[model samples]
Target: MRRFRARRRQEPTNQMRYSSATDVPQVVPPPIEAAAGRVTESERRTSSQRFRGDIQGLRAVAVLAVLGFHTGMPLLSGGFVGVDVFFVISGFLITGLIDREIGRTGRLRLSRFWARRVRRLLPATAVVLVTVGAMTLLVLPMTRWSSVAWDIATSALYVVNWRLADQSVSYLASDDAPSPVQHYWSLAVEEQFYIVWPLMILLVLWLQRRYRLPLTRAMLTGIAAIGVPSFIWSIVLTKTSPGPAYFVSTTRLWELAIGGALAILAHRIPRLPAVWAHLLGVAGLTAIVLAVVTFDAATPFPGIAALVPTLGAAAVIAAGTVGRRTISDLVLDTPIMRDIGTLSYSLYLWHWPLLIGAAAMWGEDNELPVTIAVTVVGFSVVPAWLTHRLVEAPIHRAKVFVRLPGWAAVLGVVCTAIGVATAVIVSLAVPKQPSYAVGGEAPGAAVLDAIPAQDPDGRPADSVDLLVPDVLAAREDLATLGGEPCISELEGTELEACSYGPEDADVTMALVGDSKAHQWLPAFQRIADERGWRILTYLKSACPLARVDIKYEDRANQDCAEYNETRYDRLHELESIDYVVTSQVASQAYLGPNESQREQTDAMVEDLRRTWTGLEDAGRQVIVLVDNPNPEHEVIECVAEHGDELSACAFPRAIGAERGGAPAQLAALEGLDGVSSVDVNDYICPGDMCPAVIGNVLIYRRGSHLTATYVDSLTPRLDEALIAAMR
Candidate 1:
C-alpha cells in the first residue's frame, strides 16, 4: 500500500507547467504487471484508449443531418438530432483529450486549451458575423435592424443562446423566416462546454493525485453519480419548461458526460471477431439513421430519448477501425464524408446566414436552388479551410499560444469593438419609429386626429379602469388623454381585460371587441367625453367581441366565452347606457362545440345584430362601428417587429368581401332594423396594402393588434359614426 501511494504521488510532477498541447510531454506506460499492481481492474478498464472512426463518422452524420434539416430536404426531417450527436461527440473528444493529457502529465493547461479552442472557433465566426452584419444592414427592414444587431453582438460573444431563450421564440412557432444566427444556440452550448470542461478535468486529476486515487475509477464513479442526476434534471426541466431546457447549459451537460463516459471506457471493449465488429457497427449506424428519420420537433429533447442516438454513437465508437471492418467504416472513411467532417464547423457557421440572407433579400417563399446551395457550400469550404490553416493551426502550433496574457485581453477588446461598431451601424441605418400609430394613423398627432371624438353632452361612456397613472413614466405623456387603460387586469386570472369607461358614468357606450377595436379606443374616448357617454369596455387579447363561442388551437376556451357573456350581462343591467357600440373584425376565430368557422362567424354577427335590435326595441339608440381592416402585421408587431416596412405595416383601405373583410361582415348588419353600421375603412386603409404606419405612429403594437395610441386616436371618427348611426 505504501509503495502504491508513493508511486501515485510521483506520477503528478510539480515541474509540469500549464502550457499548450504543443508543449505537452509524451506519455509512456509502466510495465503491465507493475501498473496493474498500482491500478485496480475498474481503473484500468475505465482508462483504456481506443480509436473509433464511427465517432468521426458520427460527426459526418450529425452535420449532414443538421444541414439537410436546415435545407428543408424531405429525407432529413429528423436532422435536428444532429445537434444531439454533436453533443455526444463533443463530450467524447473533450474527455479523451483531457484524460490522455492528465495521464501523461498529471495537470491540465487550462488557458492554452481555451486559447486554441477560441482560435479554432473565433476566426470563421468573426468572418460570418461581419458578413451577416453587412447583409442585415443592406436588406433587412429598419425596424428589424436593431434586433439583428443585438443578436449579432450576442452571437459573437457566444451568449446568443441566452438572449434567444429570453426572447421566447416558441420552438414550435413556425414563422416563415427565422433569424440566420438561430443555429448558433448549439455553438453556444459547445463553447460553454469548452469553457468549463478542461477545468473540471484538471480538478478531477488533482483530486486523484492528492488522494492517491486511480484516475479511471474516480471518473467513472463521478460520472455515474453526477451524470444520472443531471439526466433526470434535464428530463424534468425540459418537460416542465422547454424554453429553459433549450437555453440553459446545465441541462445539456450530461449529454456531453455520456461521451466522456465512453472515453473513459474506450479500451476495455472485448476484441470481437471481424464479423461481430462489422455487425455491431452496422447495427449502430442503422440505429442512428432510424433516429434521424423518425425524430421531430414534438419529440422531447436531450432526455432519455436522446440516448438512442448517443448509445448508437457509443456502439460505433466501441467498434474500432482495427481488427473489425464494417461497411459503415468504408462509408465514414470515404473521402466525401471525411471532407465534410473536416468542414463541418465552417459549414455549420455559414449555412444559416446564407439561407437567412437569401430569405431576407428575396422572400422566404422562394427556394434556394442547387446553385445557391452549392454557392453556400463553396463559401463554407474555402473560408473554413483557410481559417483552419491560417488562424487555427498556426496559432495552436505557436509557443506563444501557451504564454499569452495580453493576447486574450487584446482579442476580447477587438471583439468588443467589432460588436459595438456593428451595433452602431445597424442602429443608424434603421429608421426611427414615431409614436401613437396603433391601428393605422400617424404615430403622434396624426393618429390623435384620426381618432373619433364624441360630441359634448354625450354621456355614452365612463372613465377607464387602470388609466395610465400620472406617476409612471410611460403614462406621463398620456395623462392628459384621460381614458382608462385600454387593458385592465381581471381579478383572478390577472389577464388584461378592456372595458369602456367608468361603469357608472351617466351615459354608457361599450367599447367591445378584440385588439383591433382596442386600437380604436382613443377615438372612442373623445366621442364619449363630448357626449357624456359612460364607456363600458369588454375585451380580451386575440379574443374578438364576436358572440360566437370559439376554440383556440383545438382547445375549448370556455373562459373567454364566459367572460364575454358576463360582460354582456353586465351591460344589459347598466341603468344609464342610452346607446350600444360594438366594434370587432369579422374573420376572428371563435371557440366552442358546434362552432365551425362559418357558424361562429354567423353566430357572432347574429349576436351583435340581436343585441343592437334588442336595444333599439327598448328605445335605446344602437350604433355599430364597422371593424377596421386588418393589417398583415399585427397591430403591435407593426410597431415592434416591422417598423421598417412602414407602408407594409398599415391596414389596407380597399373594401371587399374577401378574407379579413370587415366591410362584408358589417354589410351583414344592413338588414337589422334600427341598427346602423358605421364604416371606418376610409380612415384606416387608403390603398392596396394596409400600411402599418400612416403619419408615423406605429399602427399596431404587435402584428394586427392596434396600439393604445392608435386606439385612442379613433375618438373623432367613432363619434362621427355614432352620431350618424343615431341620426
Candidate 2:
C-alpha cells in the first residue's frame, strides 16, 4: 500500500478501476416443435448472447492500459482512464442482454439470469481468493496479514468497496499499506450493479406491461432518474473528499448509466455513413489516448474529468453499431486481441496481487524493472488459463440447476464457505503485538551514559527485544496524542484547544505546532503532573506555526495560514500564559516566490525573532524543542522485517543531519532573546549512527515522531532543559 500523505497523494491502483465482463457467444437458432410459448435452450442463448468481436478487442485494450499504468510506465500516467472505458463496456453489454431477453420472451427469467452470472464469475473468483490468502500468509510480513485477511473476507462477500471508501477517509489508517485485495473494490462496484440493475429492469418491465407503455421509454426514464443525481453528487464530493468519492459506488453509477442509455436507444440511433463512422471511431480513440497520456494522479477524477474516456468509449461503440466495417471491427478482431479478451477476467484478478506480493518480497524502494514486470505479467497467463479451464469453463458448461441436478449450486455454496472460513482463521491468527517480557525500567541520565557506543558497522551492541512490542504496536502508541476535534485536521484551520494537568495550577505552559508538537504531549503531561503545572495544547495535523504559507496537493494551504493567524491572536489575548513551547518538522516547509533556500531560512529566523520578541516583551518565556531526525525509510517496518540483524536498519547520521532538525533550529533561534532551543538528537542518534533501537527502545514510530514509550523515558532530560529555560 502506498503511504497516504496530505501533500503526497498516492494514486489508486488499477484494480480499483478495471473490471472485465466475459464475452457472450452468438447463439444458433433452435428447431421448431417445442411448445409455442415455452422457451427452448437456443431461444434463451440467442436472447442473452452476442458475439461482438469489437467489444472483445476493447476489453483487451482496457486490461493492457491498466497493466501498463500499474507497472510504472511513464507514458501511461493516465492509464487509470481505462477503468472508465470498462464501466461503459459493462453498461452496454448488461443492458443489451436484458433488453434482448425482454424482446424474445414476455417476462424476464430473474433466477436463471442470476444463476448464469454465478457460474460465469464466482468459481474463478473463489479460487483466486483462496490462493491469494495462502500466499499472503507465506510471503507478506505479519503486520500486513490482518488487514489483508479482512480485505479478502470482505472481497468474498462483495462489499469491500464500502470498506475501502471508509478506510480512504480514516486518519488512523492513512499510512497503511495497500491491501493485496484492494483491487476488489472495482469488482465489488460491478457486482453491486449486477444485483441492482436487473431488479430495476424488472420494475421497468412491470410498469410497461401494466400501463402498456413502451419498454425503451420506461428503461430510459429509470436510467435518467438514477444517473442525473449521481453525477451531481460525484462532482460535489470529488471536490470535498476525493478519496471516498473515488471508491464509492454511487459516484460512478452515471458512467455505467451512459452505456445503459446507449444500449436502449441503439435501434433509434441513425445508421452512420462510412465516412462519418470512420471519423467518429478515429476521434473516439484519439480522445481516449489523449486522456491516458495527459491525466495524472493529481487530476480531480470521476467527476468532469471522467467524461473524456467514458464518452470516447460510447462513441466507439455507437460507431461500430451502424457502420459496415469500422476501425474497431477491422483492427480489434485480431487473434491476439480476441484471445486476451477471452482471458481478461482471470487476468484482471491475478495481476494486482502478483504486483503487491512482489513489492512485499522486495523492499518498497526497489522499482520493479520493466523486464521483470513484463515477465510477471506473462507468468499470469498460467494461473489465468488454468482458472478459466479448470474452474470457470466446467461450472458454466455443467449447466447444473438449469436442466441437470443442483450439484453446481451445492458446489458454489461449499466453495464460498471455504473461502470465508479461510479468511476468518487467517485474520484471527495475526498477532496484534509481538510476545516480549514486559518489564523494563525507564533509563535515567546515568543509565543512558553507561550504554555502549555503536560498533564499527554502526550496529548497536544491546539487545532490541524490549523494543519489539513498541515496533509492532507503533500505531497504538501514536494514538496517545488525541485525534480529530481535539487536534485540528490536516485540511482544517479551526482553533481547537485541549488541556492537560491540574486545572487550578498557577503556571500555564502552552504547546503549539503541527503533529510534531503533539508527539511531545505524553512527556509534557508527565512533567506537568510531577511539577503541578497546567499544560495547554493547540496542535494541527500538517500545519506548522511558521508565518510562511505552505502547499498541500499542489495548491496553497489557505487553511494553515488562517489557523496560524488565529493561534497568534489567541496567544496574545491569554495574559496569564507564563510559557510557550513550539516545535515543527521543518522538512515540510517550502519556499514562496522569490524566496531561495537561504532567503527562506532568513525569513523563518525573522518570523521566530518577531514572535519570541513579542512574548519576551510581554514577560513570557519561550522554549523551542528541536524536531527529531527523520529516517530515510519507515523504521518500524524495517525493524519488524529485520529483527535478527537490527543493524541493517541503521541510517547514517550524515543523511539524517542533512534532512532534519539541528541546522534549521540553530539558524532560526540564533541570537534571539527570551527563546531557548533544546535538541534530543544526541539521545536519539547516539555516536553519529541512528540505529532503529536505542537502550532497548524503538526510537521513532512512523518516520520521525518519537514513540510515546521512548518519549516517556526522556522525561528526566526534558525536565532538566525546561527548568533551565525558565530560569
Candidate 3:
C-alpha cells in the first residue's frame, strides 16, 4: 500500500551550515532510530522538496525595483533596497544548500562546493566588467578617466568597497553623480562575506560534534552570538562613521546569518494551509515593494532599517504553499513573475552600468529618455539569458570539472588573476581622447594618440595657462615669485596665532572669502609685508563672501552664508581694516538656464554695495576683487599639451576681466558712491595671450582655480592693483 502525505520545511531566508558530523545534530537520535528504522518508500515520498513560485516572483520584484531605480525612473526612488532583498535571497539559498549537503553527507567537499559557486558567478561577471571598461574609455573625460581606470582595477580585484571608503572623505566622492562600477560595492561586500562564512560554519559544526550538542541548539547559539553583536556594531558604526560602516564587511555578516538561521529550521515547519500560505507570501512581497518606495540615500543603512526587507524576504521564502489563493496565487505565482525571477541575477548585474552609461552620455542636466533606460534593460536581458544557458548551464552539467577540485581551484584563481591583470594593464595603457574623437578621426586622432604620452619635461604644469606674458619661460624662472617673509614675533607658543606683517606696519589689510579668497593670500601677504601693512584673514573653504540670496550648487549653503554674513558684520564693526580684499567663484558654482548671468551679477553687485556702504559708513575702505577666470582644463595639462613649450601655449587676457555679460550690473555697483572694482586681468594677463606660469609659479591649481603657490607669486602684481583700487 502507498501512503500519500505532504511534508513541509520552514527555512529562514538567510543562513548556512557546515559539512561535518558536528555541524548539525542528527535529526533523529540513534536509540529512537530503531523504532522508526523500517522507513518505507511511502514515507520518503511525503518529504517536501518542491520549488515555491511565489518566492521566485518576489525575486522578480526586487530586481525590477533596483533596475528601475538605476534607470533614474522617478517611480522607483527607493529601489536600492533591492540589494537587501538580494542579500536575504542569497542567505536563504546558500544556507539551504549547505545544510542539505551537510545533513546528507558526512563531510563537506570544499572543492566541489567552490566549483559550483564559481560556475554560477564567474562567466556573467566577466562579461559585465569587460563591457564596462570599454564603455568607460569611450565616454568619460580625461579628467575623469584616470579615476575611472583605477576604480575599474579595484572592482576587478573585488575590493571596490575599500576603495570607496578611502574616497568617502573627499567632496568629489559625494558629488551628485557617481560612476557606473560604483554599484560593484555591493558585489565586493558579498564576495567578502563568502570568504569567512563557510569556514565559520565548519568551525561551528566541529564544535557541535565534539560537545555532543543538538545541531539546532548549536546553530541557534552561534546565530545569536554572531548576529546580535554584528547588528549592534552596524548600528553604532553607521551612526559614528556612516560611510566606512556601510562599506565594511564586518557589519554585513548578520544579514547572511539571518538566512543561515532559516537553513537551520528548513526541516521543521509543517505544510501551511493553502489560504494562509498565499496570504503570507503576498504580504511579504507587498512589504518589500513598500520598503523600496520609502528608503533613500539619506536613510542610515545596514542597521535596523535593513530588517524590514530582511524579514519580509524570510516571510515569502518560508511561506511554502503555492496553491491558488485569494491574493498570492493571483499576483505572486504568475508566469511573467517567474521569467523575471529566473533572469533576476543577470538583470541586477547589467542594469546599473546601462543606467550610468546612459546618464553620462546624455549629460546629467538633460532629462534621460524613458525609452533609453528601457532599451538598456531590453539589451541586458538577451545577454543574461544567453549567459545563463551557454555559460551557467554548461558549467553546472559538467561533473568532470567538479571531480577535480584542485584543477577547478587553479582555473578559478588563474582566470580571476588574468582578468584582474588585463584590467590593470588596460587602465594604465589606455589613453583618453576627447569625446569628439570617437565621432571622427582626423588631426584630432593625433591629439587623441598624444593623450597618454607624457611630456618630456619633468615638472608638473600649471592648471590654467591664463598668463599673457610677452615671453614664456620654464617654471624655474620665478625664484622670488612669492613675497618676502613678513613675521610678527609674538610671545605665545601657538604657531598659527602668531601674526605676520612688515617690521613697521601702519595700514591694516584684511582678506576674507571662500577658498578663492584663500588662494589670494600668498599674494596679499607678500605685498602687505613689502608695504609695511598688516594682513588679517577671515577665509573658509568654499564659502564665498556674500550676504543675500546665498546658495551654491542649487542648494542653500547655510554654513557659507552664515559664516560670510557674520564675518562681514564683524569686519564692519572693527575700528581697523583700512583695506579689505575678497574674491568669489561666480560662474563655476552657479550658471544655468534658470540662473542667468544678469541675475547673478545683480545679486553679487548688490551684496558688494551693501558691504561697501556699511564699511564706508563706518569710516573704512572696501575693495571688490573681480571673479578669477576659471579654465576649461588644468593648466599643467595645457603646459603638457604644449610640450612644456610655455611660449607656444598662450592664455587669454580677456578671461577674468569685466565683460558685457555682467558689465551693466557692474555699472550698477559703480553707481554706488564709495565702491570700486579692481581688475587684476591686466597685471596677470598683460597681453592678448596669458601664460600658465609667470615667475616660475604654476598658474592654475586645478582647471580654473588659482594654486596657492602661484597666487603667492602674484603678490607684486596684485599689490599694484590693490593700491589703485584702495586709492
Best of the candidates, lDDT: 2
Residue 685's lDDT in candidate 3: 49
Q: Give lDDT tens digits, candidate 3, residues 690-716.
A: 556644444654434555555554565
Give the better candidate number (2 or 3) by TM-score.
2
Better of 1 and 2 by lDDT: 2
Least lDDT summed over 10 consecutive residues: which range in candidate 2?
26-35
Which is the better candidate, 2 or 3, if ranked by lDDT?
A: 2
**Highest TM-score, which number?**
2
Candidate 2 per-residue lDDT, tens place, 472-585, comes to 577557635333235676555579998776778988998887777888877787888889998888887767676766544433456678898999887878876888888877
Lowest lDDT sum, 10 consecutive residues, model 1, at: 1-10
Q: Write the per-residue lDDT of candidate 1 for residues 514-633, one digit (tens) a residue.
A: 544555666766776676666656655445544555444233344456666766665566656676666655454454433576766666566666656665776566666666555443
lDDT of each: 0.55, 0.70, 0.56
Off by over 4 Å in 1: 1-53, 169-177, 202-214, 224-226, 270-280, 300-305, 321-323, 364-382, 397-399, 402-421, 428-682, 686-702, 705-708, 718-727
Error of 2 at 372 (Å): 3.7
Backbone clashes in each candidate structure, one number apiece? 99, 2, 27
Best-first order by lDDT: 2, 3, 1
